[model samples]
Target: MTAKVSYLISKPVVTINKGTHSIDAAKKMAEHNIGSLIIMDNEKLIGIITERDIIRALGKGISLDLPVEEIGTTKNLITINENDSIYKAAELMAKNNIRHLIVTNNDGKLVGIISIRDLIRESHVLKALSVTSEQEWIGSD
Candidate 1:
């Protein structure tokens, strides 16, 4: 059975509006202990600004005082529905080489987020189980 995205997306999301400054986004990122925030406007999922975006903006000498829309990846967005499978969500991340994904509702409102680290943590648990299983098999044999 495919794991549902509802089990993976981070809830009670921290979001930013297009009018918000890059500095504000960075501050929220740190305060929320998250690497990215879903950008919204009028309760609609718009864009996303990640830690990498903030760093790249700084590298280009862009002012933090500028709006997040100035630095956010607005050109190509990848969003997933709430009921999608975890495998599909992971596939999207692998294909896009992104660590985070925006979770949207039927109306495309920002709902939550999922991260590559979340998937990695799951993989780690499975690896531990696999190791234990192998150990038991060896001992029994």
Candidate 2:
């Protein structure tokens, strides 16, 4: 069976308000040990913040004390449905040059989040599952 984005979901997607200080966003990411944080406003998913965003801000000498959005948080968030194929998720990420993705439900509500690392890990599982045994391998000397 082909894997789906739902299979890659890590529960309880972390989030932050757009107005939160950039430094606070960084700290929140560190606390969660996550690379990105979803940005929600009025119970609506808006955008996302990542370590790279913070890095860019620092490189530009932007104050970490400023609102995270001021750091130019990703305005266009690329999302995938939880039931969508994992291959689709990977394709979107590669096409967009992004490392993270938000998983939404049928109602377009945040269900979870997935990262490139998750896809890589899932790929290994798929590979292992594909090779049931060495005898099943297609290659031969």
User: What TM-score does candidate 1 get on C-alpha atoms?
Assistant: 0.82
Give candidate 1's total backbone clashes.
0
Find the candidate with the highest TM-score and give its number.
2
Native-vs-model 2 lDDT? 0.83
Q: How far is candidate 1 from the true structure (C-alpha RMSD, Å)?
A: 5.6
For model 1, the stretches where C-alpha displacement exceeds 4 angstroms are 123-141
Q: Encode model 1's per-residue lDDT on 1-141: one tens digit a residue.
A: 656777876557888988899999999999988899877776767789999999998999989998887888776899889888777777799799998988878877767888888777676435555776799999997
Query: What stretches of model 2 exceed 4 Å from their correct place?
Result: 72-74, 124-141
Which predicted model would earn the best lDDT? Answer: 2
